[model samples]
Target: MPKQKGNLWTTMWISYLETCLNNYLYSGIWFQQFQKIIIPHSQSSLMTKRLVAYFLINKVLEETIRGDYCKNKNIQEQADPTLIPKTIITLNQVEASKFSYIVGWMLFKLIKRDYLMNSHPKFSVICILLRSLCTEKVEYDVLETKLQTTIIISRSEFVQFMYRLESLVIELFEKHNELGSNILRYVENSFLTNLHLNQTFIQILKSSNGENNSELENEDCKFIYERCVLIYMKSRQKTWRSVNNYIPKKGTASL
Candidate 1:
């Protein structure tokens, strides 16, 4: 890794970012700065350096929102339980935008861990929203189901967002079900690790699977059907009607 030719703060910000993200420390000094930090020049970029600092802090809390409780004891002691990680990240609005990718990537990496995936909603929503906003086109797999890609926010929090995610999901799912379902279904399945709690979502899925046939229009629906089948098979003994009946002979569904 080549050294970055920058002042104290610029170097400090880059070092702290690398430390927090656990990535290569000194590689791609030019491109990483351009892509990740939005820093272009090296001479007395104090404003840019401070922005980087803000980005790193927000990225840390945002990516590991739920885990922050266990990880940042000082932050935990200082914060109110009701305050979500999303709120904290957006508090410094300007800096947060600059570090969006870092925050998003952190959340992505965290949700891949099952224990972390099942841990808390704070982290879950961060993952879901980030993916939804950032990843426009991607493939769906068991990894999506296993990971905590969606927040599965409580009804109470849902009303307060000043914007409803369900409406957003419906709109996005309607337009881009493949990507939407890829993100939404993960939220549906893993948001509440306890399947019993998400009875409403399960029913919505059950109804979709119960009636739909091989002529599926939305890719999200297909992904959701596949995920529901797996979740049902894993947690409950019964098989979903969507899998056993609707799926064609070419495909197979199992736990």
Candidate 2:
């Protein structure tokens, strides 16, 4: 009786794992289709573009992370969780690795071409999505570490991206004040705690006076600079609030 119960438990666990793997495969295929049909087409309506970007970003958290996690040789060597009872499971490490890489590549492509920066609505969506992705705690710490390292290595490109991003944000605010406010709020909520990213913003703001003085004379450039200052100040406030929250009260025991 005990042997039968143990077999049943094993069967259930395997079924669960199989479902996860299959779901990952399905999502990967779907995301590929999404990018091909929706992402690259400049003819897409603003709403369609925003929806597609949001969808892709949301999928990155679960599908991309899981797919990347299983790419490790040690993890792959473990028993297949999704195998059916009495069935042999073939692990395709290459396919598994492609999941995370595809998402990263897509994002990089968007960033490289400055697509995200050119469209105000799409840029807003992407920024919010990126903030959510980076700030959220995942089950696997390795995934977070990998993401942070990627950002650091690409800091120059990212800084350039942020310059463009800030310009667009200010432009949007000028055109639609409410939308601009929302964008600033999103940035504060998502990126306030990110020290490295915040520091990069500071450097950009400081350098503007020296290198971008002429550009700043333009009306649009003036608006961008003012908006950037607002964002930087708001970020500083949030950082101090976070720090204060962590300070132990007098006589409180330190953890």
Candidate 3:
């Protein structure tokens, strides 16, 4: 087995992208330019290439946020304990904005495209990226029937963000499109890996299997219900309910 196949391929991919963009890789703005170029070109390119762009963006985010953590032992030693990866995040405000802008746009597109009916590995990684934003350590707090671990993000931030995410699931599930098994696998693994600390999420995953109905709507509802439970778990009051009472309101939510 060759040891360097992955890294060597990545090196070549970066070189390939640099040539196409006619620009050397810089830090923040380079991702913006990459996204801009891809949007129009994507319609005519293979879907697999568009998915590769997701992985590329995620890798770029890791590089910008972790800085030299992988290469420098000193940075790893100095990382914040509260951070799961235990590395310094973002080189500066400019770097942080770049991360946010790209990630937020991807979520918006995923909502629009329904991932073109395919699961993306980087979609789960996107959830992990949001976890990086919490500045404080989590604690065990009791809510109603059981003790709960506060999420990696703060109560206010987590609730607000998940509420918006719930809306995304609602929008997508409402489409009644037949979701591919790959997408379901990614969604399940995302909750199991990144959100296993929350017992409710685990329960939702377990319950989904006992479901007998094979209808597409029922399957979609499983994930939609999971998001709703997640929002409930993150709520400060430990319960959540909302009505769409929109009269003059129509806009998108951003991270």
Each prediction's Cα lDDT score? 0.35, 0.39, 0.37
Decoy 1 TM-score against native:
0.18
Candidate 2 per-residue C-alpha lDDT over 50-169 given as tens digits, one digit per residue, 9 for 90 to 100: 677666655765585455434432322332222212322232688434423333433343333444244534344333333322222234346556533333122234334344433333
lDDT string, candidate 3, 1-255, tens digits: 225554334445555765654443434465456668866456545456546665787687578844443544332233222212222222367844443443343333333334432263333433333333333334655567466543232333433344343333233222122331122222223333343223333343333344322322433434433443333323311111132111111111100
Q: Against the true structure, what is each candidate's TM-score?
A: 0.18, 0.18, 0.21
Report the C-alpha displacement of residue 133, candidate 1, in angstroms: 21
lDDT of 2 at 127: 39
**Regions of candidate 3 where Cα sits further than 4 Å from its true position:** 1-83, 87-90, 116-192, 196-255
In model 1, state the lDDT of residue 240.
23
Pairs with backbone N, CA or C atoms under 3 Å apart (clashes), candidate 2:
17-82, 18-82
- Those runs of model 2 whose alpha carbons end farther than 4 Å from true positions after fitting are 1-117, 120-217, 242-255
**C-alpha-based local distance difference test score of model 1:** 0.35
Per-residue error for 194 in candidate 1, Å, reads 5.9
Query: What TM-score quantifies how close candidate 2 is to the native fold?
Result: 0.18
Model 3 residue 36 distance off true place after TM-score fit, in angstroms? 60
lDDT of 1 at 39: 49
**Model 1 misplaced stretches (Cα beyond 4 Å):** 1-69, 72-190, 194-197, 209-255
lDDT agreement of model 2 with the native? 0.39
